[model samples]
Target chain A: MDTFAKLQILSGAARYDVSCASSGSKREAPSCGTGNTSSSGICHSWADDGRCISLLKILLSNDCIYDCAYCVNRSTNPMERASFTAREVIEITLDFYRRNYIEGLFLSSAVMQSPDYTMESMVRVAEALRTEEQFGGYIHLKIIPGCSSELVRKAGLYADRISVNIELPSQASLQRLAPQKHKNAILEPMALIGREISTSLVERKVSRRAPQFAPAGQSTQMIIGASPENDFQILRLSQGLYKKMNLKRVYYSAYVPVTADNRLPVLASPPLLREHRLYQADWLLRFYGFSAEEILSEDAPHLDESFDPKTAWALRHPEFFPVEINRADFATLLRVPGIGVLSAKRIIAARRFSLITYEGMKKIGVVLKRAKYFITCSGRSFEKPDQPPALIRQQLLLSENREALVSAPSKQLVLPGFFA
Target chain B: MNQYLYDGTADGLLSAIAWILEEEPDPEKVMLRERMDTLFEEGFTIGTDATLAESLFFRLKQFAPDAAHTLYSFMLAEKEGMETSLLHYVSLAFKHGDQVKGYLTHPAVRDIVYIAKKAGRELHRMKGLLRFEKLRDGAYLAKMAPDYNIIHPLADYFSRRLRAQHWFIYDVKRRTAVRWNNGSLQFGTIEQFTTPAFSEDEKKVQALWQAFFKTIAIPERKNPRLQKSNMPMKYWKYLVEKQGE
Candidate 1:
């Protein structure tokens, strides 16, 4: 205890593990080590409610003997419990990575006095930040659930990424909300760290260069409006953790009720626009190809909070709309609704040198007032292309309420052109 | 006229887009002068003629040595009918040599890689939503000018989380500064600077990070139209912990 009171009791009990991404690690910056992984990972820094606080994220103790009722360091939440000593979390992550403040160490804890003594104090703080503070930065760690498989393979040889919070997406909402967590102790250590990071990338096993094992892979988190799950049973358990635990991300969060527990749901916050429309239908099922029963069903378990989720699946699949933007293809111009994936790779590289017209799909930016009544060009129809899909969803919800009353000239017109 | 001056830097716009792809000129007597004493009083100042810009930078490194530094940083961030879109992408990279990497999926080289990846995702979200406080002697300041070189990848994520803290940052559009302290990281040119005074516990942790950003903004998801489409009021004046309130 001390290292700023074990970083305010293990980052207030690892701020309920939201898995703030440092991102799919790449590792280069060791031509002569000191640190560097960033191929879009460690640079975080959000905290204004969007959270990510550029990694000092914390938790090597919250002294739990498991009383999980939506955890606030659960052994009946009175708070204040601390633990550090892995040389005070490697001298407060090398005095906050040598005083610039932080670029790594998210750690995590709570089993405390056992679960292999909290996975041998989180594998002796990633083997004392890789063999006595040679700390090549960006760590992440977490794996604890039923620990061993050789301490989740020595937490993927000094962690660049590793996660295991399946929390509550159903095993009957993890036995009525975290009943001392089990579902094969959180999916057999995430299927043994996804089969030891796919047999160390298909048997290219070169010992100590094992640093790439978790190269920013594995991500999990699910709480979302807690318990009675449904955004089609949490996107069919995120399409079986992205088709059987290859998992790069799952995250969600939302259920912020804090605690009063009569089996939860007395919510007054943390539906956060249904966890921001299930991270925009998990980015239209991982980059706008869309699946998980074409973005919801089971009597539509909630999502149309007016448009978006690819314009509510392009106004309920009006026979996959007018789609023509000079002969669509990159997955039908990424299913129209305000085309993105860099505007469908800029309308497949500006229709191979021109012929795209609706004024060249508004100079290749698209979003022609919601892809101009879906699309069609060289057969023009910026608007009326056989209307009546309920008057084209009431003239596209009345031009998104006249572009939300010409975008706030002093509030009032709440979401009208609902993201026109 | 043949009046060349170039030097606005990026190796003087890759030596005037390699002297109009080897001296074809006359796109109305091609004039792009940033200054070498802006020539032309009846022309003739071709002094960027670093041996005709190293023979069109060795014929664009023998026609695309993996896109010769991304076509010399998109011909020094080209604009204004960028020399007729760098002379029809160097005359379609000399008629499909190395199949001109399919003209980098051309729409004039993807509208300069979509304005340099939307100015490098607004300089990596203003280097993760820039918010620097703590002043009274414990100097840890911040200032931005991001619009993209995104201060060398946001100084490798703010020098590994302010490595033991004596910071600086400042870009204020390339007036530069990187600083850091004791652990080391230098870089210079912030010439006449000031904005320091803060400490009252850095304005009460910037009024508790703008009251936890107005208590997590869900006035029924009061979308300041989707929080100005993922935060953009030209990043509300250096987002000092979202001036919110």
Candidate 2:
């Protein structure tokens, strides 16, 4: 087949993997070579799915040996099978990078022949891009499970970021859905990559000339709604990954049912809203200093659908309301529903220069409609801050609807109480 | 109206600002000379003096280097009524020193910061949005008409990234282009340029990319609204993948 036809099949098959980040590596351009990596990654285009196309995310081949029930390219599935030659992969990467079509290449493959064979083929492409072409662009290699430690080590040397997908949340789900993939086959490589990454980071600190092994670190993804794992369990697993594995990011993909499997739960649509809420909660865990247990409890295992996790938390902890915007510390300010990492920092800095007011709150990027209900400026609350949490929740929900109505004014449907 | 007009360059804007501080305090209107005729009551088109502009910028830098950078970015914005905003922001920066940037409550500081950020983001976006097609001689040519004047920084960036290849980045709207021939850089206008013969592999690579672009989108989750919001319709004219769309 031609390269165009091959790319169409390979990229289409690779769309299930949702790891799209190309940031966190600032590889200096080789003296007379093409392309360079920026610390802040650039998106060449936005796929109609709204995901940023930072890298040429494609598989070297999609012909699988393992029969994972949830995957679209499981061995039993009747789909187009194609693989790019190592030379073809290199040429495509160089051409795309030169044209500024992608930040770099995100190369993955199924168990083509075996784990070692597939990984070696991928490493050849990466090593050639680095050695022959002097390509300094970002390369994110998806490590095949059950791959050798030696190949994993070699892959890290050329890749800026490496990910080993933990595909399912629990061992039980892995056993039931994917009997072929062992939990150890995935975790062992993750452990190895994590160790090498930290070792390289320490070495780089000692000497600038040290070869960086996965300078952007490692990340993993688990399919949400594929197995019976609740949001609490998913978040707990992510928190553990962050704390233990030293993972850069933990992606949560809302599982899209492709294969007709008896093991998988039937859904009308991918649980995208749940996926979005999980991302918000993940942000709270990583940036906002919230823990998994803090965000959710055993009783309340699911995130509240009406409001975001942050607002929901605020409503539950009613005593935390009327948080003095001017007097609150950075951490406290971040806990507020409307204030984000940026706005919280802004409020902190701006307050040092001048007293923050209700109007100034809006100016400094605070979403006052949500903030006004839960915060006080200069010991003065927006509405006394004595309203019940239920009332506050209703008011916040109303404001959000009003905003939704205003933004999509093209839609003739209007919500009542918008004027009030 | 008390009008202080100047040329539409950053230096000219600074010189007019200098005129405001020293000679013409509290000018009701500060704008480009091309627009001065419409509301000309009493106006002086301040001759853009590099030394005077430098000295004013020097003072602003000493007070707040970040504010100075923000002002430079704001000048790059070149929006209508931008001179007035620049004048107000500079006066505030001089009075409040580095604290002026964080003083988002003040409309003057807020407006300048917002415009500067907007202009700066365009420069960053164009770094990825730029598309290069290889010419027959192996030189790459990209054409863009960005919302802001970002070609200067965009060219400076690619000069390093593509230092091994000859390339020209043309700003179609501004009637200018930046050329880097393997190593050295050149800047001028290409008044009578046409689509030259492309290299043998250019069409093949573009088709492959367009094919990859189509296959990448998940059919189940097609949100054109979000895609358009990120990569606006205005930018799609030059994009190869958005060719058919």
Scored by lDDT, the top model is: 2
Give the lDDT of residue B165 in candidate 2.
83
Q: Candidate 1: lDDT over CA atoms?
A: 0.65
Q: How does model 1 do on interface RMSD, in angstroms?
A: 12.1
Stretches of candidate 1 off by over 4 Å are A1-18, A21-58, A67-87, A99-108, A111-228, A232-250, A253-278, A282-312, A315-335, A341-373, A378-420, B1-115, B118-245
DockQ of 1: 0.03
Q: What is the C-alpha local distance difference test score of each model?
A: 0.65, 0.86
What CAPRI-style quality would you assign to candidate 2? Answer: medium
lDDT of 1 by residue, A180-228 (tens): 7789988888878888888887665656454467767788787777677
* All candidates: DockQ: 0.03, 0.65
